[model samples]
Target: NLTTNISPLMLMVMSLERYVAVCYPLRHASIITIKNTTLSIIASWTVSLLNNLTRCLFLLQFSLEKLETLLVKDYCYDINWFPDSLRERYDKAYTCLVIISAGLAVISSYTGVVLAARSASTDKVSALKARKTLLLHLVHLGLSLSSTVYHPLLMALSTLVTRIVFVWVQDVFYVIIIILPRCLTSHIYGLNDKTIRPVLLYHLCGQLKISVKPGPC
Candidate 1:
């Protein structure tokens, strides 16, 4: 959950960095200095930690004894942990807030970059690549947000499917919604970044190949 929260925040930071770099190239160095970047990262992690701590407070209403008695399967789901109406409402509200705010920030940042890219002074190729990377960030954000609906979707499917089929479907959703998004960030950046692509591909392909020339974004 900490990682999930931090991921979008980090993406927002990246988007803003690109926004400044493309939209105001002359001022980017001064505006996005190493100290500022470090502080932004620290702030992001702090916010994520605080958010998760608040989430933990929701579990406090349940006594340890009560929690121990609650029946659970071999695997525990977040819905099971948050069985009460209060937690459910809080979860929904928080999820929507994060998705909307982060989505808007990223979209606005990328839109600015795109507009700046059209200017005669900007490097069109670099700006175009940044735009593509931002698009991927949006896709990743959507995938990450989809996990919030996983339980409700599974519950809806449970009535229509057989037990065996439902179990298989659950596994599929678990992988697609809960797992894949976390893994995509590395692949997205690694392939798009020229400096990292060769090294990423070398290790990914068992270190047999030392170089790979990828096409433009």
Candidate 2:
């Protein structure tokens, strides 16, 4: 959950960076420097870590039930363990607060970026680049939202229905949504940029020469 939290926070920061770069170009280099970017990342991670750590502390107050196949076959919900007051009420309220705030922050950041891309740039090349950047972030935001939600319901169904089918579906979604995003993030963000493409090609595929032409690599 903490790891999931970090991605959206980082993406929002990236959107803000893009906003400054596109809308306030003259001052962007000075305003969004390496030190500040690093600090922002650290702060984002810190917030996520703290939230999840508190969750862990809450969980540690109770003992987890041991897994039993017979119990799994009979019951979908855990009979051995029940939600205490902390989780039943407080945890949900806290989760809602965090979700609302973070979701709004991310959506606002990206929306500002898209609006900035549309209105601030007149140059066709610059505008196209900004659009592409926005598209990538939109895809990221969709995937991030999916990662937080409903398919876990399928996993819950596994305990009641045929255990294998829903579990497989859950696993497939996990791989596509969570694992692929983290693993292919470099390619998704970097490979399409002309400036970065040569470096990636050279390093990843051992291509000796990437002609620095003005077209697709």
Candidate 3:
């Protein structure tokens, strides 16, 4: 679960980078050059790795021998040994941090996209394309927010089956959040822009190649 959680956060950071590059080309080029963008990506990944590692440290502090003895097949670490209040406090803090950060990212990105689209410098075709891209990102932004919001409610819900169903639904929605932006940006921007043509083709060919691959990694 730690590994899985990290991917979404990394992707969110990538999406933010994309929004900056697309919507604020002039400023982005000046401030977020290739080297800076690469550094940002590395930083996001590093932070996520450290966050997961911190969770592991907590696991080490609390012994897991009993959980191992119980034969729980899939759990990477035991949480039950921690006091419920302590667990809930961590949960609340994590949820709040993610929600606020993601929300601000979405707002900033969306506003930038909107301003870019409305600019007098943007021609008709470019404006239309930018709007389409913004819409695609907005869908993803909404889903990301919904998933974060749903998580705490899912935890607080009384019924076990309801919680299970809620989590599964959120998981599927989260997958969509990962995939939709990639497809939309790659294809939609690639259609008209000579610069993004390679990116479009890359994602397209990549998808086809994955389709033919033997099995899931």
Candidate 4:
């Protein structure tokens, strides 16, 4: 779906934004000005629209029955959904590109953050904070990519899996993919930021600046 493709693009943009902030503090002002950021976001949405929307159009070319088989949750509905086909090939290639692009962004951003931290002559505290921030970013990216639950080998197993097993696998991983990235990661972001932390804590704890009652683990 468009959402899946855009998720990776958004991650790439955020990585670049962080990279600019840490690696090019002076240049950051001019580089990520409001107009430039707007353009970058517009570009992300445009790419997602082109890539996934084109794929959806391709599905429309097929008959109703064929399109039904080409489901978004086809892994659960049909174990053989990823069978060899032009469409499947394109889908896999698109996924590969998204992952590769995100991987490169992560590497570049993390490297910049580390280098900037080391180069900071006076602000050791800021350097430490940058490192912590990068750590959180790494964790978030992993979770966003569904690395904890979705491995390459397990993905490969999709072609070999039986129906019942594939269904269960799909169901479990779908939750991790959808809910974890969409909801919890945002909370993680808010929890780490100074301005947003108190707001989130107040809503979560039902009190401002008070010891939060232990809720669900």
Candidate 5:
């Protein structure tokens, strides 16, 4: 849950950074300093932690009534454990809030970059690259949010298949929906960022002793 919440928040920050870089190049250096960036990251994690702690309290409140039933359950799923009306509503509301906020941030940042890129004074090449990076961020955000539907998706699939088949389907969905997005983030950044690509390749293919040249690979 902490990762789930923090991921989008961090992406939002990254998008904002790109927006500032492209739209207000001179101000980017002054505004996006090391201390400011560090504070933003710290604040994002703090908010995510507080949000998770709040959800935990809600889960505890709802679970108290079904303590015995929960204790006997072989597997613990959040939806099954916190099936109360209030908790479910809270979960949905919070999920929507996060997704909407992150989506808007990415979209608006991209839009700003596009507008700035059109100006005669701006560097078209850099703006174009920033636009692509922002688009990837938007796609990555969607992939990350898809995990929210994992439980309901599995529940629907279970009714259509045998237990064995349903289990197989569940495993596949878990990997694609819940796991893949998190894993893909590093690759997305490494491949797209010129500075990081060589380092990433060097470590990934270390046995090959790949050269980390300043020139394009």
Candidate 6:
């Protein structure tokens, strides 16, 4: 009932696009062939829609008030309608499926970019910039994985001092990794203006007229 209108179809389209770009770089357009892409896109939506529909249908049969009264409201489901063991297996299977799909896409995309870079011909400065961009994306991917894996672990050990220290360290590392680069870049470019000091000082001195009156001097 509370459909947030989130379409899992978009994820499929994105995954297929990446798959084409990586697996068929030279003939991506040809191999992913418009027709095939459309089919894959449609299939992805159909599958996701069906999955959600089934879950909703199953849930609809149960009374929410009754379900909420259970001790483990989040984990508890109607075992009579769907066995507890079966539900657990389904959860594990879907979790593994998502992890594999996302992991493969990240790996495939990185491999494709690395291979493409090797075949590229560029000047030193331009090449360095390109490599830096690629490395930044890879690092971002690693951070995402670290956050997902460590999030629950951190929550579980929140009471322990050592765990608290580790969690904070990880958070700080993530913040630095994301923020330090931009700060460094700004400083590097800001230093390039040779007249910056003089110009700033001149403005601060207020020697120039404030121009309170409309008439020119």
lDDT of 6 by residue, 36-57 (tens): 8678767766665665566546
Cα-based lDDT at residue 107, candidate 6: 55
Evaluate residue 92 in candidate 2 and report its C-alpha lDDT on the 0 to 100 scale.
63
**Candidate 3 regions off by >4 Å?**
6-24, 64-85, 142-217
Candidate 3 is scored at a TM of 0.58
Cα lDDT of candidate 6 equals 0.46
In the range 1-217, model 3's lDDT, one tens digit per residue, is 4433444454456456656666666776787677876887677677667766665555545455555554534322244444235654665687577666766765676667667767777554544554555555556555544444444443454244564675676567556654444444444345545655545555868644322222110
Query: How far in Å is the alpha carbon of 129 misplaced in model 2?
Result: 1.6
TM per candidate comes to 0.85, 0.73, 0.58, 0.71, 0.88, 0.40
Q: After superposition, how far is residue 178 of candidate 5 from its true place, in Å?
A: 2.2
Which residue pairs in model 1 clash with each other?
none
TM-score of model 2 (CA atoms): 0.73
lDDT of 4 by residue, 2-114 (tens): 66556667777777777777666678799998898899889988998898666655544566666565656544422244334676667678777877888888777877777
Tens-place lDDT digits, model 2, residues 1-217: 7787677677767767766767677898999998999999999899889877776565555654532322444335432233366644554675566556656755665566556656645344654565566567657766765665544465467566665676677678778877766654575567767788778778777777756554442
24-75: candidate 5 lDDT, tens digit per residue: 9999999999999999999999988988787777666754656776662333
Output the better candidate (2/5) by lDDT.
5
Off by over 4 Å in 4: 63-84, 120-122, 147-171, 206-217
Each prediction's Cα RMSD?
Answer: 2.5, 4.4, 7.4, 5.4, 2.5, 12.9
- Residue pairs with colliding backbones in model 5 are none
Give the TM-score ranking, best first: 5, 1, 2, 4, 3, 6
Could you tell me how far off, in angstroms, the CA of residue 81 lies in candidate 4 after the best superposition?
8.4
What is the Cα-based lDDT of residue 60 in candidate 3?
48
lDDT of 1: 0.83
